[model samples]
Target: MKRRFNSIAPSTLGLALAAALPCLASSTAANAAPAAQNETSAPPADSRRYSARGRGDRRDKWIHRWAPVRNMWEFGIYGGVWFPSKHLELFGPTMSGSGSGNQRLNTVAPDVGLRAAYFPLRFLGVEIEGGVMPTQTRSSDVSATAWALRAHVIGQLGLWSVTPFILAGTGLVGMQSASPPRGIGNDQDVAIHFGAGVKVFINRWVMLRLDVRDVVSNRAGVGEGLTSSPEILLGLSFTLRPKKKKARPRDDDRDGDRIVDKDDFCIDVYGPPPRGCPQVCIDDNDGDGLDNTEDTCIDDPETRNGFEDGDGCPDEVPPELSEIAGIMEGIQFDTDKDNIKSTSKPNIDNAAAVMKKYPSIRVRVVGHTDSQGAYKHNIDLSQRRAASVKRAMVEQGVEDSRIETAGVGPDQPIDTNETADGRAKNRRIEFQILEGAASKTVKKRGKKPPKDELPVEPTPEPKPDPTPEPAADAAKPVDPVAP
Candidate 1:
């Protein structure tokens, strides 16, 4: 059968090219724009130049900026028109009863393709590309699909964010069709391809690519020549970057210990020479004078109240003693006399109640005098006052032996003696534990008595006991005398 073919269809080719024009134009315009427009708003100073002040070259500036693209793998998909040669050979019948003659494959075929490339260096790479074009023979109603695959070596140059490249490679081309023309069923050929493309990098990972390639293949059957097919393609590509290898540190000292991390036992801790680690020497964690090794209560410092100073524990005192001290705060005496005020009888009774509450702890009635009087007279008066307090406690059901008396006579002032408040504090009575289950002391400081109250006559002073008085008070601060 003789066959005829009109010119190739323009609609398919025009529509595909139209779709790609806007993108191509925009990319080209962007790439062609002046370098200044694409530069950073404030351009980085050229490192090669010295300052106007004639200092030194600014070589280290912008050293930390990251590269947009380097060695990477690219994969892309493209679609465009494949324009085949009009003289493309197809072995088939050209006329009625003819066994072999010239016939043509379809001129215009819509082509789709996939491309993968790897760039080991900045300017060189290798790519493997595969494409499919669906068309038909010009003389018959038979449909056919043509496939071409090629591997190419690419050379490229990076200009700003765009890369323009050229490639050349060779691979296989094949055709599959139903009831193909005579002498031509399924045919395969060795094809050579040369192409040039440009990649517009949108970001570090995504890019737009436009390529045009001339695919040359040997004519099948009786023809001894080759035909060329041109492909115009536009595609989107994604680049994958290889993970960076970490370099070993030459010498690293994180803790500023003067020791390199490799040989240092504790790289993070600043310490001494040998191990480069800290040695915790906690001789006294509680700051109680005694070493932690000998301290029974390492967390709590010792009271050191002259009770049991050897044992490193805070001496536990009865709360009743504090209550008795509070009650004695109301224990006012007649001015400069051992006589107890009659109005202070209630406070004396309350103090006796606290002493009776915990009868196990022994009590001492120690007296203090202000610096107003002669030292010897103050001592004599304070001693008589302490005796009176003891007598009162004894009358309130406290055992006479549990209460002892002493007079410090302004020697140990808890506050400043220069002030009136300090003198009032000095002239106070204290309750100390002479022999008790818990070795602790309590002091009850009295405010000045009201002059309107009557004074009880002083009783005879008790005989001095041979027992020694405590050297000092406990670790706690003395309570101020209440008004």
Candidate 2:
């Protein structure tokens, strides 16, 4: 049984190796899984790929999505078998005779290999390696040994804790066997090897690797020419350099919007719930004056009322109420005349219509004049003219109580009084729609207009001559004639 086992057929070993590979791969996957790291070490965005961080810059990250290792050095020890494609024919002394002979060698033999690699960059490395194995030209005959040494360039790609690499190298190979009636000397030659394999990191410090190499040598002490031998090795490697430390995104974004954190007013949150950090959904739109954080009504458009309209909302003013300034060009008057002009009718009609439409409106109809007349006379004229205009509007069905009249004389001219055009422009009328209807600035509550500004009362009608007590009333006229 020992003799049978030692001479195991080549076909049997091939079947055994093929059956064992999948078992090794499955075992490696099961044991090589990495533990989750702290949140500080996790990438900022994707869970798989390295975090790209800022915009546009995509270089300088791990080559593998799941492999976290960067630049480092690795040292590994490997043990495997070298199988010859064709039987190696060795020229050596025959065990049965005292003469030299040749015999084909085909057998499974064990080999030991060692490797040292330097990874200067992420995906590239250089390795120096050597291996030795004892050999036999004939299965039960005299045994010999072969040695190989190489310097290889390694190119690697890693994915999800597994790194696969390919190697190409040129090296030296030697085979020697001595034990016979005619001892065989050493056969040495230059050799070239190329193959590929994989490495699985069980952790940062330890990894498992498997390599396959095909070595072509011109000088195998064989009677036949060159020999092509393939070798397979599995190794466990240790890293000499420490694992790299990953960085987490900074806490500078307090609002979770990715804006400068210090610039945010409503820090630590995004409004309307389900907020913060992982997603930034807020939008400025630039429609309102303020940013979304400061806005109370975030979606409402600004009123543009020239107020603090930045709250992303329009001012709440009634549709019927609007400033009388600049609309319909304000009321205008002829020089020294307080009577409503035909051109002014359209404006008056609009004002009356506004009042009729909304009963809450109270208006001040003010009269102004040029500086041509005496100050006091102008004051009185402006007053009467304003009163007369009020009466005309009262006739047009506006409520007298809703209207207030004022005469500023030349005190408030809208234009220069030195020219005719200025004088004409100066003598004008204005309808100030009181703010009690909407905003607070138009008029103050419960405050009366100045006493001096109230319109003068109209002259009283004379009573019918005291109903004559005829005779007695006639005596007074007669007495003057008689006396």
Candidate 3:
């Protein structure tokens, strides 16, 4: 059998080995895969339905101005056919053939490759590639196998699911092993390669690739002097990328209610609704829009007439409660809170009693706050405080329809905000009695108060003799008699 094998022509032997390589590589690859991933197993995500969010839209100027981080890595296994061109056969003379020059190495052999690449930029990548192929000479039956380890640089275009790229690289290739077991051949040569490929990302972590390359080597001492060859491969790749963390801006919540403004309906004030706002005060026990921190009558309902109001309470207000704060004196609220205090309940009742006594009075509740924290938060707190006060009166028989509410926060501080006591004084609520057209309906209707109850009007300073008619200008006014 040995003699017969040695007697076979080199051409015949090389052809046989060239054809056997594909089967061997395929079998090896198949056995290397996990048993569960069989031919009939499910495939990966479909490329037809694959897309990244906002992948192809117009991007902002700042995005294009700077480089984006590239964290994706690619690893793949490829198998294909390589055919050396006619000119490549000039590397060495044919062992056996009748011709003026040796024919080119024409054997079509299978090449197997392992590739790993990193993209530092979105459109560019650097790759490390290793491959092995069964090689044959065209002039005779001489045969060998070649292996290579190379470094490549590639450029890609079109940022989408399907991307096309061009590559160029250089490396060392060995044919014939130093030890018989090391490889199929012992000869080594330096070579360069350039190619193009298309990558199809099925998802963020997997892709399919089709690659073609042209390799050049100088092997004049061997079968060919100068060689250039082509390899066409198909491969499946596994992509690696780090998980992205979401970013949130500090000012996302304009009103520090812990709810982001994008979803908050009451962007300026706080309320209760999913993605709307948080409950205002968190102390409105009576549902009368009054918080216990400031409500004088924390036990009653400041319920609205139509419930279609956002001013802390319902529309019904007692007429006699002309000034909301007047009914409850010495009303002091804790800093940053809006709940009505337990100690102020009687004062709240007194205010309610006074309103019931004077049914015609209209009350206005104004909220105040010290300059201890954010101005905006202070404003909201004051408004809530005032609303709670009104709720207290409304619960104690006061009409919800007749009361008016406002919050000035620290804007109208009556005392110095720098001192604790001053701040405390500044934070006190004020109730002002209103007469005449203070009511919205009354002002719109142009009605005057009854004669029996005279409206209090502030004394006005008389004009100072109209500046004595501006003596010089008055002297020129005699033209009125000319007509």
Candidate 4:
């Protein structure tokens, strides 16, 4: 059995190595040559600067550092076969029959024992064990079973994944015999043991292990001899909790962008230059004049007058105005017509309500006609139609000044006019606000005549008198007369 086991061990090791080679090769390829070359070539400038700032290995210098794992505790169970090397003796006079020339010698016996160990330190431990095993003897043909308890101090070396350990201890052993049948007896004894083992961490919580130990013990009685035993075991271990890492502190200068709160200068509104503010921080994110930090509607540029504090974005965009051309219901229009059919009234009414709500908002009303008619006539007709819509809005209480009317004669169209639907869409009206009206109020003051209409230019205002000249002129006159 031993020869077979020894022969199989090499095969198993070979298989394991074979299985690991690809991963090992990949890791070596990833980290070996290129990394070494990079390190040699770059010679990190920062590392040199840091070393100059300190003496010796700055890598080990005491800087604020984080440890991912520190203090932890583990628990586990172990099971193994025990073998005893010590000899046990039967304590009786030599077996003899008087004058019969028959004599017998006392016997020496050996037994096997089982054990358990607990490790308080990862590398060292103490073990307590108890077991009973049958013993064999030479001489009187006496047979017995020995029961023993021992305590051992243990030490381990090598990688945590595969550690080897040595142990030593002393304990009391009790024995009972048959065939001269001596009853139970006790003796103080010492034991020495050594073992090698491996541990596999299944996870943070558990580990599995296998180990073997050889034990030796001594005893004295009618006869003395040496005993040797070996044990094999499998075990499982557990940890109470894993260690937690400390967080690293950040180094920041002028951290005013809300990135590092402690180092921030402008905690509320990020400023530019020395404050580390964003480039666009001052411009309204919503284009609403209110900076992004304060604007609730950062995406829209319109303002809400009632709130007065929000960025100019309206609390809500009017649903009617949100559409592409502010037309809903798929309403189609005839060329150059201001007269909306009954079907289109609902969409128009919705837009009208928005205009009424935002009374200060001014809209440009543009009319377009298809290319079927003469361009000039189409332009005239479209202009008339746009004026008609303006009149309608004015009648509907929308301020005339708030609506600018214009006509585009077949210039802008949604699609090719070769198609009927495209031509119909081409003949349409659209509303857009004058660019700056949202920021500045729109007032409908009467139109003043053009500068050309009111005389080519106003008579230049009379130049102001350059100076009070009388005193100078009188002095000059007197001087001239004297000359």
lDDT scores for all predictions? 0.66, 0.60, 0.61, 0.51
lDDT of 1: 0.66
Of candidate 2, the 10-residue stretch with the lowest lDDT total is 271-280
Which of 1 and 2 is ahead in TM-score? 1
RMSD of each: 42.2, 38.5, 35.2, 32.9
Query: What tens digits encode model 1's per-residue C-alpha lDDT throughout 283-385?
Result: 6667665556656566777663323444456675556566664225867799977899998789788778876776666666777777653344455666778
Error in Å for residue 74 of model 1: 1.5
Candidate 4 yields a Cα-based lDDT of 0.51
Model 1 poorest 10 in a row by lDDT: 58-67
Q: Which parts of model 3 are misplaced by more than 4 Å? A: 1-69, 85-106, 136-143, 177-185, 219-225, 249-483
134-210, model 2: which lDDT tens digit per residue? 76765456576777888989888854458888999898876677755433446666878999998887755678888
Quantify how close model 4 is to the true structure by its C-alpha RMSD in Å.
32.9
Compute each candidate's TM-score over C-alphas: 0.39, 0.37, 0.39, 0.33
- Ranked by lDDT, the better of candidates 1 and 3 is 1
- What C-alpha lDDT does candidate 3 achieve relative to the native structure? 0.61
Going through the candidates in the order shown, the clash numbers are 0, 1, 42, 9
Model 2 reaches what TM-score against the true structure?
0.37
Give candidate 1 misplaced runs (Cα > 4 Å).
1-71, 90-99, 180-184, 220-223, 244-483
Task: Report the C-alpha displacement of residue 396, candidate 3, in angstroms.
Answer: 37
- The weakest ten consecutive residues by lDDT in model 4 span 61-70
lDDT of 3 by residue, 392-452 (tens): 8899988997777766667766778669889877777777554322233321111233456
